[model samples]
Target: MGETGTEEAREFAHSIGPAFVKQYYTSLAGTSLSRHDAFYGNTSSFSCNGEPSILGAQKIKEQYVKLGFKEVLVDLEGGTFDFAPSHNGGVLVVVGGSMTFAGDKTCPFTQTFFLAPD
Candidate 1:
């Protein structure tokens, strides 16, 4: 990611962190939560921190409710980067998943995001 992209990702992550963790623990039964990013143009593999589970999901939901967001969802486009606006005036997006397909085959890069709102 470029300078701008890095900054944007950091800001977005900070803004959404609370909601994510809370929601995971509260509603999804998630235990721990962590996040990472990969620039669209970067060659490194996409990465995320922490583990995911039903309890963790619930915790994430609780975090979301603590935030101002009324609703949260993972709305992404086909590209590696996507910007999603939250009900709390914040934005959630996928920073990287860019891969080029060949011979009618899809790229190996895969990323997934879930949202929870307060």
Candidate 2:
């Protein structure tokens, strides 16, 4: 690609991680627990904390509801995101930070996601 086109692509790639993270976090921070379901398609799969993988959007949403976080707090400023571009125009995101479920309850976490472009 040309110089300006390359720069624009770089900037766009940088913005993708934060925007995706914001949307994902927003889904977890509200009463609408099912909002995140939009992120998953019928072919999507999810696995939590070494648990067996769950397939399909409905099942994944059900598993999340079962977790019943009710509340989720992340070390926003302290969090870090690593991104890698995929061959199919997707981005692999690795997020690391401390998470708190309630007052004085916190644990370090690292989550990975493959964000496929629409």
Best by lDDT: 2
On residues 1-118, what C-alpha lDDT tens digit does candidate 1 reach at each position?
1233466655665667545534432331222223212111222222334444323434443443443222323222443544554444444544443322223333333344434232
For model 1, the stretches where C-alpha displacement exceeds 4 angstroms are 1-53, 57-79, 98-107, 112-118
Tens digits of lDDT, candidate 2, 7-99: 654565567878888888778787557688998988889988999999998898888777654466667677888765654567677888876
| Residue 111 in candidate 2, Cα distance off native in Å | 0.9
Question: Would you give me the overall lDDT of model 2?
Answer: 0.74
- The local distance difference test score of each candidate is 0.38, 0.74
**Which candidate's TM-score is highest?**
2
* Clash pairs for candidate 2: none
| Steric clashes per prediction | 38, 0
